[model samples]
Target: MPDLALDIAFAWATLLLFGGGLLLLRARDAMHRILALDVLVSIVVAQLTILSYSRDVSYYIDAALALALLSFTATLVVARYVTRGRPF
Candidate 1:
């Protein structure tokens, strides 16, 4: 029962993340897109955390942490590029 519950939860989360990502892709403003990207990344992290509960491994958490940091940096860089008109 618990296993089935987890599977359902994962499926729901995946659908939500994909939907949010598509919305982000359709956003007109770069900033809005970036924010949406952040939301998607967070959803991915949440999914990974849930996976950790069943996998008996903490590696996913570490990767999720790394992804959080990388996503933050990516958002900052894209914002800067959009604002400054250059990578710099």
Candidate 2:
């Protein structure tokens, strides 16, 4: 079973995820989409952390950390690609 408050937070995060996806799709500028993507990733990390707390499991935290790092790296690559036409 999950903690109620954390579960509510998770639900809110899911809602934000949907909202972020909509924002990303609605955004016309490349930079605006990138910003929306970052916000989405941050919200996902928060959700994962909440899941870990609610479940009393340590593995989700590890997954969340990995996700955060991956998101950071991916964002950097995408930003670079946007600016340079190549990820490298």
Candidate 3:
């Protein structure tokens, strides 16, 4: 029963990930693109976390953490570049 629930959740997450990618591609403005990219990253992290929980694997959790950090740094850099015309 619990496995079925996890599978359903995973399916929903996958759909959300796909939608986020589409939004990222279709965004008209730099800021909108950045927001969509952030959403995509967040969905990826959520999928990784769900995979870790379903498989009882510690490495997936670690990878998710690393991905989250990288996404945060990237978002900050992009936002700075968009606002100031340069990221330092």
Question: TM-scores of the models, in the given order?
Answer: 0.81, 0.85, 0.95
Over the stretch 1-88, how does candidate 2's per-residue lDDT look in tens digits?
4467777888899999999999999999787888899899899899889888877899999998999999899899989999999999
| Local accuracy of candidate 1 as per-residue lDDT tens digits, 21-78 | 8999799988899889989999998899879887879999998899999998998889
Model 1 scores what on Cα lDDT?
A: 0.90
Report lDDT per candidate.
Answer: 0.90, 0.90, 0.93
Tell me the lDDT of candidate 3: 0.93
Preferred candidate (TM-score higher): 1 or 3: 3
* Best lDDT among the predictions, by candidate number: 3
Candidates 2 and 3 compared: the better one by lDDT is 3
Candidate 2 lDDT trough over 10 residues, lowest sum: 1-10
Question: Candidates sorted by TM-score, descending order?
Answer: 3, 2, 1
**Clashing residue pairs found in predicted model 3:** none
Q: Scored by Cα lDDT, where does model 2 land?
A: 0.90
- Please give the RMSD of candidate 2 to the true structure: 2.2
lDDT of 3 by residue, 52-76 (tens): 9999999999999999999999999
* Highest TM-score against the true fold, candidate: 3
